[model samples]
Target: MAPEPVRETDPTIGRLVTDASRDISSLVRKEIELAKSELKVSAKAGGLGIGLFAAAGFIAVLAIIMLSVAIAYFIHWAGLGLHWSFLIVFGFYLLVAGLLVFLGVRSVKKVKAPEKAIEQGRQIPQALKGKS
Candidate 1:
């Protein structure tokens, strides 16, 4: 039986394969880093959202207390005692409530989803290819 000759890839092809593999490995690493960065941004945004809710709740409670005191004062000024003072206090509370609602809505609307890090990471390869 005749011995079969081993076929080898050209050096250029071999180098291309090596380079492609390295490029892919680097791309994978960059994707992982991008995901990590995105996740961190998302976590921070979530934390901010929670904090905003907490602040809104606190402010609501404080507003209620303040409105109560204001009503008492209005009643004393009216010379009608606490009974008639409630109307003025209630109006004040309505204004505060409206303002708070506006602010809360604004804050919620301002919250943005984290930008995709992987998308940005992919651009690097595209840019490199373009430059070539």
Candidate 2:
């Protein structure tokens, strides 16, 4: 097969500019596509993690319900009437719940804002501008 002769026409500035602009536009579109694909994957993983966490919490709640019933039955066997046994179990759960709420509130109150980190971040601009 004979090789085709090369006809090289020097590209004009306008042509070069148009080609560069087109290439940049194509590059930007490709980058946006890549970002969308990456975000889809991350969102899927995040949704799965949330689902698993909810399942774990649901199982824990079921376990707690079963334990409460079992404890109530045991109390009944220990000579307490069935009604009183369940009542005692219910009261115990209420007491525990109240204690948990109190502790949770205390722990939340003890939490302080990140003042040191905020101060450091504020200093960054000053440092960069040689004003620190």
lDDT of 1 at 76: 78
Clash statistics: count for each candidate: 0, 0
Candidate 2 stretches with Cα past 4 Å from truth are 1-8, 104-132
What are the candidates' C-alpha RMSDs?
15.5, 6.2
Clashing pairs in 1: none
Cα lDDT tens digits, model 2, 43-129, are 999999999999999999999999989999999999999999999999998999999999999999999999999999999999999
TM-scores for all predictions: 0.45, 0.68
TM-score of 2: 0.68
- Which tens-of-lDDT digit does each residue in 43-122 have in candidate 1? 99999999999999999999978879876786778697675577667787789999999999999999876668777876
lDDT scores of the candidates, listed in order: 0.86, 0.96
For model 1, where is the 10-residue window of minimal lDDT?
4-13
- Superposition error at 4 for model 2 (Å): 22
